[model samples]
Target: MNLSLCMIVKNEAATLHKCLSSVANVVDEMVILDTGSSDRTPEIAKSYGAKVHHFRWNNNFSTARNEALKYVKGNWVLVLDADETLTPEIVPQIYSVIQREEYLLINLLRQEVGAEQSPYSLVSRLFRRHPEIQFSRPYHALIDDSVATILAKEPKWQIGYLQGVAILHKGYQKSAIAQGNKYAKAQAAMEQFLAAHPYDAYVCSKLGALYVTTGKINEGIELLKRGVRTSEENYEILYELHYHLGIAYSRLQNPKQASLHYQAAIKLPIYPILKLGAYNNIGNLLKEAGDLKTARKAYEAALKIDDNFAAGHYNLGMTLKAMGLFTDAIACYQKAIKLNPRYAEAYQNLGVVQLKVGNHQASLIAFKNAIALHQEQNPEEAQRLRQGLQEMGLL
Candidate 1:
């Protein structure tokens, strides 16, 4: 049941400690392969008793990950990123699974937080140590290689997906500028790699996401649509492409097309975020179309999946307000504010509902609160609040 935790990192001092600490007691050995870090990442890994190995940056993730795999001597190896951590519930599951010899690879669900969705999905992170299990694909490296061909001959070899544990990915917290730099480097590498392998669907899909993040909406949409057309049966790439396409179409104010892509995204089995986000977006689009009853149903469906989602409550309130259901709208806004007190839009909408119901005094108070919250982040919204107050002669 011995286990080894392996990772490759660079300039990750800020999150390395948190990542390593989360699994320090769960594994028998920790191996960290650092790629020319200028920060104290190596020192921090050493402090956590991790066997640190230094490797020069080769602009290839597969090479680095394969090198890290060479240092793993345990029966089971768990690959993790410095920005990711094993949840407390997953540790017991890993130990239980490793005790049995039936599985060669165990894929756990990865939960990417701070995004607009459920965040949880499946990925292969844990594997039985075998000489044949090598990594391939330069940028977003994967373990499926010629090893799969060899393993297919072994009648006892089996790969199973585990639902007991999930890896929390926190890599998206970097500032926009910092993220832009990382994406730039990744884009360069991916472009060079694609020159030699132009039909790589995964790299094409990843490049599309990078373009979207960098504000190249048209290029992103084109690349994503191309990837979708080429990789029709590839659910992961199709789901991501459709999701990004939906976002791009929404930005272009083509809600009908956006709704179509969103519906396509939700049909994929692997898209948790797409599932919830599609419902929310469809709700908003329906509200904009003046379909209050359908919009309310969509919001309710989103709330049923995630009760604490403030956006769902806020949108539900807006839909109720559009139907002239003032009291119900106020209740929805109150719930939204309870979930997220700093939600200025909820306060503003609440004020609008109050004014419609002829509660000028309460409307003034809500507008004031909205203005106070909006002052620092959004001056235009603050001005709107002030205008509302002025129209009521309360300013």
Candidate 2:
């Protein structure tokens, strides 16, 4: 089956080449709709043999998406973004999956990068190109309903999940945020969506999450609660709602409530990354409450899932140090540094522990390394480390 790779972009020159090069040979056709890019984006697209069409900036994602869809000539359309990449390993799998006419739509795992542990979710991006199969919503647009409509008409049409296939999403990287006001634009779009869909669980969840991102804690809590209430059979939404509620409660300094919600989210059969986060957070809360034993157990549980988690090891080290287990704490800190060499806080804490045990030379080396890593990233910590060295007469 010939696949058409469709995308809408504007001023995406920095990421356009990476995205196009990843799937250039995989797709049969490339339909790129440029929404007024003053950069070399259109030229770059043309260089890649993409059918680049100019589109006006309409403040609507779905509008641009639908316009791009009109130029797709292939039977199968694979929607992607400028910051998204289709891995080489998944190319043949995507081809094979779409070749089968049994499924009208395929949901691929979209892995969000730029985090210590990347989280993934099943997203609908591959589908048959039918005239009625158009995108909806102004922003955070989707065609799930269109696919559902097609499935309703043709009852035999199935939705397939391609295993071991993922789309690497780099849209959430810091560079993207620094270059644009995507968060603010998305927040406004969510508000527009929520105005009509007052009880929509998904939109409520999205808006709540946006509010949390923008530091509107109370509003986030209220909307997340509404999302939880309205979310009927979606365990995924429930898990997210509970998880965010746990975070909001933590921010509010209500550790007991935070722990309760974290436990609630942990009880659900969700993603392991989320479960690991819950365990790690629960440990932090327990540690804050002066329960070193329980906190140790929580960190142990997190390590059980992912033993190589650097933060988990560093946090466990802190708990051990608090409990006066210097040897164990040192081991944990060493393991954390082994996993993540750039962990400045782990180095700083290791120095503190070494200083406590009267290992002046080792403490001095660790503090110096921490200062080197922290100088630009954390000036306050760098100053404190310098002061510590001066006090020890090692400066």
Candidate with top TM-score is 2
Q: Write the per-residue lDDT of candidate 2 for residues 88-172, one digit (tens) a residue.
A: 8887788788879788888787766654332455678999888789998887788886886887888988888776546988777
Per-prediction RMSD in angstroms?
A: 3.6, 3.1
The residue pairs in collision within model 2 are none
Candidate 1, residues 240-357, lDDT tens digits: the string is 7787788788778899998899788877876354366677888888888888899899889888876767888999999988888999999999999998788899998998899889
Taking all chains together, each candidate's TM-score versus the true structure is 0.82, 0.86
Candidate 2 — worst ten consecutive residues by lDDT sum? Answer: 113-122
Error of 2 at 114 (Å): 3.1
Q: Which stretches of candidate 1 lie over 4 Å from their true place?
A: 116-121, 144-158, 174-180, 271-274, 308-310, 325-395
RMSD of 2: 3.1
Tell me how far the alpha carbon of residue 362 in candidate 2 is from the true structure, in angstroms, after superposition: 5.9
C-alpha lDDT (0 to 100) for residue 229 of candidate 1: 74
| Winning candidate number (lDDT) | 2
